[model samples]
Target: MLDEVTFDIERGKIREFVLATHAGDTVHTSVEAARDAGFPDVPATATHVVVAGHYRDQRAFVAKLGLAYDRVVVGSVKWTYFRPLCAGDSVRGVRRVAADTRKRNLRFVTLETDYLDAAGDCAVRVREVLIERGAQ
Candidate 1:
């Protein structure tokens, strides 16, 4: 056995994902998350669900990297809502590193993920932006 150990994560500094708009994914989940955070009246619809879940996912992603937050700015989410994610439904997504930019006071990492659904052979897409603060 080795007496010491070391690790590095610089190589995977960024990550992205794409998902599909699915049915059965009610907006309830998103509304609940928002309500739990002290906000109520969030539209509990499929469209809102994806947006809210996407944000939560983004935050989780940053937390996993042990990033410290001082300032964070999120870009708008552009997604197309479609059939619910249920039985016999199929979807596709693309996850990749988006952008890494820093201001004078802090460093920022922006990650974007897109999702599409199989509806009329047209895919609906959802783009999520996550900003990580103080990352150099």
Candidate 2:
């Protein structure tokens, strides 16, 4: 696993992410609405971590794995949410290469990132599949 990355999920970022993603849920944008819905604060939208990921520069790790940006294509992304993520939560995530295989001219890589909440409980897990095409 690569070194852990930490991010504080803030309210403004959550609201921005919700607005940018066109998430029409009031709970994701307003703390009052979220609290009314039983959340401590504005709840992050699904996949909001993708925005938080910007704080961690994973490009170096990807380059270390020999993945050329031009050759890599994101195959799929899967997220398993174990608990609601709300604004003001500080999360830590560890990323590792879960699998790698080559078939014909295509190389498939599975990267997994597991995130933990401040209480050290699992919050979310993200699995991303990347396909790299060999030069003809």
Candidate 3:
């Protein structure tokens, strides 16, 4: 039971931070290459590492709730890459419930977050999908 569900059935569901990038986050050499390739910035794809981390975080939360694929009540994710974050740039991370829904025979949830750089510029937007697996 996610905390946001309006239904009278579930318990409070909370989101655990999945990933964050900050100053000192190791940037692979490939990121530098992309910047040099005239993309005006490091290839955004490399940032998937952050997303993967968050996914792992989410998985842990699900497990703690005794939920498996067939027991998900809702799921959704949305990510926004705002700008390039160079190496040595401090970044902040935060995550919270964005929205929740039960429809079309399925439950849907969105996890929203943002990463900000030392300069106070948004570097990345994180959106995660949480889907409800039928009760296990």
Comparing 2 and 3 on TM-score, the stronger one:
2
TM-score of candidate 2 relative to the true fold: 0.94
Judged by lDDT against the true structure, how good is candidate 1? 0.40
TM-score of each: 0.38, 0.94, 0.52
Which candidate wins on lDDT?
A: 2
Can you give the lDDT of residue 125 in candidate 3?
Answer: 72
Clashes of each: 13, 0, 25
TM-score of structure candidate 1? 0.38
lDDT of 3: 0.47
- Error (Å) of candidate 1 at residue 37 is 37
RMSD to native, candidate 1: 14.6
Candidate 3 segments exceeding 4 Å error: 1-46, 49-70, 73-78
TM-score of 3: 0.52
Error of 1 at 51 (Å): 6.6
